[model samples]
Target: MPQMLLIVEPIGQRAERGRADGEAVYQRMLDFAAELQAEGLLLGVNSLGSAAKRLAKRDGGAQVWDGPFAEAKEMVGGYFLLDTEDEGVAMAWAERCPAAEWATVEIRGVGPCYM
Candidate 1:
């Protein structure tokens, strides 16, 4: 089976609506993931929080930056790893995502890993 990753961007102008609406959208996302799993198309799903830590190499050792990434216009909110036959099927699945209307969903094929 081919594997694909669905990158979900949850931060945007429309996404800042209201607390109740945000919760509703979150529930819908969970429901959609459950439906995908029930159909055996979902391998895994992850919800990413706003907090992030960036690591970098400087002159001597490591440098770190923390985030809610104040300057970013969009941040990845979550992802869905899908197992399917081909890109067409994966694209169809991506199209059915609950937040597709307001958020950005990027579908990318998973390549073989050396490690």
Candidate 2:
């Protein structure tokens, strides 16, 4: 099965509020994940730490930069790895994501995670 990477770019004040909300965003995500799991579309989910630790190799050499501070309004807050053949279907799933309504969810290829 082809794998689709759901780059969950969480944003907005609501997201910040969500962080403090008991279950946090998990409460919202769980429902969505359940739906996907029911359809056998979801594979895995992960939340990244503050971007502050992000390293970079910009240009042809290594150049470290400060992180945890994202310039984009929609920051890459988390990710959901889905196993699906139809990208459209995956997109449909992304549409229902709560973040998209208030923020954004970037759907991209998972690339080589094992690499």
Candidate 3:
């Protein structure tokens, strides 16, 4: 079995005006994650801060960018560290994700860090 990082991106405005009701949806999303955790399927899940507070590192200087990195349908607002046997199993979880049908889940494996 391998550990995979499941990054979730919301396809619509998740934290903005007119989307105030989004809080409820967000709560549901949390509930789903909790359920997964209780089943020992999910290792951990975390929500990221607004993209407005993001900083990009270049050659020398750090560039501060606005929140919500892209104008696409969704933005990566959170992630889950999944402990799964393979990508197929991980995809199964992603398909069940509340945000999956609408949002996108980018799966990445933990790589070796050369000393």
TM-score (all chains, Cα) for each model:
0.81, 0.68, 0.67
Stretch of 10 with least lDDT, candidate 3? 9-18
lDDT per residue as tens, model 2, 1-115? 4555445454554445655672656578877778778888778877655445556686788766675456655556667778876778778888888657555677776656764
Clashes of each: 0, 4, 6
- Weakest lDDT window of 10 consecutive positions for candidate 1: 6-15
- Please estimate how well model 3 matches the true structure, expressed as its whole-model Cα lDDT: 0.68
Give lDDT per model, in order. 0.77, 0.66, 0.68
Candidate No. with top lDDT: 1
lDDT of 3 by residue, 18-62 (tens): 466777667777997887788787877887655456687999999
Question: What residue runs in model 1 are displaced by over 4 Å at the alpha carbon?
Answer: 10-15, 58-60, 113-115
User: Residue 14 of candidate 1: its Cα lDDT?
Assistant: 39
Better of 1 and 3 by lDDT: 1
The residue-by-residue lDDT of candidate 1 on 1-115, one tens digit each, is 5655555565554346778887887899899889888998888888777678999998889988988677876877778888776888788888898867877778877766652
List the candidate numbers ranked by lDDT, top first: 1, 3, 2
Rank candidates by TM-score, best first.
Answer: 1, 2, 3
